[model samples]
Target: MNPTELLSLLALKKAPLVGDILAKKLIREFGSASAVFEQDKPSIAALEGMGDKKASFIENKTFLFKKAEKELEFIEKHRIKYRVYYNDDYSKRLQYCPDGPIIYFEKGKIELDNPYVLSIVGTRQITTNAAAFLEKFISEIAPLNPIIVSGYAYGVDILAHKLAIENKLQTVAVLAHGLNQTYPRNHEAYNEQMMENGGFISDFWHSDSFDRKNFLGRNRIIAGLSEATVVIESASKGGSLVTADLASDYNREVFAVPGRVNDKYSIGCNELIKQAKAHMLTKTEDIAYILGWEKKQDIAIQKQLFVELNDEEKQVFKYLKKADKELLDIIAMDLQMPVHKVASMLMGMELKGVVKPLPGKLFTLA
Candidate 1:
């Protein structure tokens, strides 16, 4: 987009009583952001949903344009990049969502062309087991070269972003604030490296400050930009669950990791599964299977199988490897290990993508 048109879009964003939905309506009616600005008051009011007050706001463009000019200066000085909703560079998945941002500012080289995009979200207070699962999950999916999207906050969100980087997969951080600064100040450490492969995206301008309510808007981008949203962990009420709901609203698949019934953080995910709102995700391959994503190449399953395992895990791994499928109790009794111990080992191996649990307590090598 040219400078004039970009400025007009910015001004349109700043206009009072005109949000993404209304702005989109105006853009469609006038053909372009610039054309919307050129229309007379009567022309603006004549359009559906436009009243005298909104028409006056569109007519009085000096204040909004001034603000847009300042934003333009910041964009130019910082070398920030932006994608207009109607442009080819915009996110294809997001384009289908009518309420997606009309324009969003970005910094760094974010490759949106990747066919497999998954948004990972969860509770801010992550558990050790959840962290381990994410590590193994990222490792398993790394072979698909999927683009990972997250809110860039602490816990599951940041963990997802960090793991994506570690695995050399492109990751996008959808921020609740503007590009001027990272929220939670301490996370600034990951900014440089994130921009190296993925980048930060935000609909807010440099002038916008961090706000609690901004998360609802941010979550939509997290949901709309991906083919699926994965919730590693979440409490009964939190932003991650909100993203899952939004993803469902967008008709995208939502998956949640199951946790023990009484676990506090697992309530949301378990509820999702019980309510039929999300698929019960146990392993990385479940994602590929449900989404019909063929493995692009071997995902190092053999390498993971050989990974250092405790004596008990080794015994169970050996037993499961030789058999097509075995009952959990049979393995425990045959190996002379406690049923609980075998169950625990199976869970660990499942996270490692070395074992998969089938119905009726059956276990098999993944």
Candidate 2:
């Protein structure tokens, strides 16, 4: 069979060991996927990590081709969009990651070039506080137009996606299952709305199913795909703490919204901050500030927020507030007692929803 028919057939049959690792190994050792197809017995056997069990699995080109034909037939018949690694438009970032998908299936329009991309993750069973915190937290960050990426799973993942779309922001769902079907089944309508706004992506083909291991694979994609990762809530296991781990490994900023110490779901986030793997934050401002965007803050806003501030926070806010303020001057100046008294009042006012903590410590007359 020709190469076109051969690949399709392999895909349709759900050929054993045809996953990304095997495909990468084949390309690395043989120098080309087509070369592996024509390989002599020893050359094929010499492929690292490919023992006889895997070697024997691909001998059938015609039969597998027939099955692959059916799979492609299924996708086209059902209208699923497919993207192969060799394709020009494959995710530019994933192509470099060792753990990236073998193939990606995109169902609708997907745009990942947003100015800011964030991923907020956590456990399946979340807290009332975590849920409430996320609602308030997202509302504050919504106007910024962030492209949020998450697993589209039960807890924080779905919550992030739901809030992003509900607020009219672009939201992408990185999936664990194949594009041929949406897993957890309950998210069908939400999934549809996302495609219209943010869209979804999966590394597997139609033959792939949502296995136990696929979720971690999903997590890495989420981490690598986003500019920053925020862990709203997590347990000792599962959810987005693992994604935070991946984000750090990938050299991206990691953040966690702190929850009460006693909560199990929040334990991972707290541990991450304790270990310095992530920064602690309550709102998206923490991320924007760390990313060096505070430089662009309005000066009038900066003056009110920074001029009367005291101590370390004052210094930091002052440095951030003005275009030029020596750190030494900040260290030397004594804070005003009235400012402290005003600060306490302001904190209360802000918490009461009467005012906001604007950039540069500027508080409007809310």
Candidate 3:
């Protein structure tokens, strides 16, 4: 590893001493870390927050450059690439955050381009309606060629990626851990797919473990990198709302897709819309109108807005739009179309970008 790379590893791998707060103070006083490491015990003892015992211990602590050799070897063996905060390729958005990660690791290619990037965030416990609605949302915007970014968690984040993948759109996942590892083991498949299709990014250097503080900071980056944030569904207080609040503070558009007023999971989203902190999106047209994307999508399609037809399709659309429920019985009773015929019609609607069929025979309108 180069001297800078070696320095970064040494800095992060060391046990937390000074909270990030004290470390900044210490860094400014010492100038370069090398100069700090070279200081005599007595001189270190004179520094602020450095009582005789702490100064003597930390000043003399073995911060030998070789201590990072093993970590360097491990990452090299796995072919991982890393970067420092000042490096050109570092995430431009994250770099602006206060005390952003000192370094980062990358698993795939990504772009910091465009005047527009939007985050798709929500709760991990998602409903079929939420999933299907997100699918249509992505489809409408795919033609406009905007970048989609999200945290690589379950629920809304996964739905965003799944829809982005199906439409062959560019996406990225901002994680809270080192790129060398993932927090949720179950997202292994999703991670691989993202690396191949978009990218997985993080502020932690290799060997860094997941930390609660790290995730809160991670939300800041998600909010910073995008032009706006959309919360599909969230609890009263959770990571999604944190990102939305940050987006609002950053002077970016914040949109929310409201659910049934009584839904506990969607209460936060409803509140955001109600409080006028977020724009309510009944269709992708809401976002499109905000971005002036009519010039981008098919003019005819864009100009018409997303119309909810009031025919037989409307009856079916209304039912699915409300939520995804098993339809074999409902179709037979409500639509009065034969079960087989209704099934065929539903499939047609799915192809037409009007609905989505979830696992286990459930369906929702997209």
Candidate 4:
């Protein structure tokens, strides 16, 4: 955390092939990043995965340290804030990821302690349907006050941030480049507003090139920072799907909205669902239910009064009110609805606080 220790971390991060995983291992073994630099070549090479060749790169500490010092100057000059992986303020979910960045920089009033953090991503080329879905989804989920995480690219990513801001929720934008500059330039307009509530996060240095491959690293951060990652829409091959895979790899929940079979952007999401890689996201409740998010006790009673139910939900609500508590199957039969449809309605209603699920698959008016 001190200047010297931070310089060592920046230098270690700059070492070629001495990535986050290996850097963390060395830090753990030596007790600190500064200590790692004090070791002789033999001592460094003796560690697992470090051979003579890799040790040689680490031995050239002078060059690495000079680069790090320049970065340190940049940090100081710009007043950018950073977090080491082991720091208490670092993201807890991200800490669980083996390959998470050793240090990431930020610029804004960002808060990661919020209990509900979600990473929502999708195709850069957004579709009307996907946009509509995100708008409604964020609005419905706003009361829970989740921190929305997304890449600050065009289309779905930017839209998600805008919606989060509109809903008065904190939204963090994970950048592929550095905080020194915004990638698309056009998105610069949102920077001030974003920082006012949330802010930008990146592991890339100011000197790092804005290469296409950097997105893989950025996607991992997005995935690691949240309890769940939702793919709003994606083409057959895109970054959002990659984030979903990374989230799943981290043992975090992944939700993908199903789209029309023939739609181009829907292919990736559909494949994710078909392969059982992601949950089929139909309604907002699916996220709340799967994540086991409970409503605040103070608002539980009032939520029902304000929730607007559709005709189908109205029917389910009326039945639950009359029956008090009944089995899912009985409710489906009594309402002349398919069991699946009724179950779906129950999940949505449960989210709205209009209904509550009881033991043995029973449902009742809340």
Give the number of the best model, judged by TM-score: 4
List TM-score per model, in order. Answer: 0.80, 0.72, 0.68, 0.83
Higher-TM-score candidate of 1 and 3: 1
User: How many steric clashes between backbone atoms does each model show?
Assistant: 0, 7, 0, 0
Q: What is the lDDT of residue 167 in candidate 1?
A: 71
lDDT of 1 by residue, 174-260 (tens): 999889989989999999999997999999999999999999999999999999999999999999999999999999999999999
lDDT of each residue in 1-366, candidate 4, tens digit only: 688899999999989878899999999999999999999989989999888887786668999999999999999999999999999999899999999999999999999999999999999899998999999898778757789999999999999999999867899999998889888889999999999889999999999867889999999999999999999999999899899999999999999999999999999999999999999999887887788775433466346534888978867765665567999999999889999999998998898888888889988877
Return whichever of 1 and 3 wins on lDDT.
Answer: 1
* Model 2 TM-score relative to the real fold: 0.72
Cα lDDT of model 2 by residue, 108-208, tens digit:
67776665788888888877888888876675565355788888888888888888776667888888877767878988878679888878887665777
- Give the per-residue Cα lDDT of candidate 3 at 153: 85
Please report, as a residue range, the 10-residue window in candidate 3 with the lowest summed lDDT. Answer: 12-21
Over 4 Å off, model 2 = 1-19, 28-31, 60-64, 293-366
Regions of candidate 3 where Cα sits further than 4 Å from its true position: 9-67, 210-214, 291-366
Q: Is candidate 3 or candidate 4 better by TM-score?
A: 4
lDDT of 1: 0.89
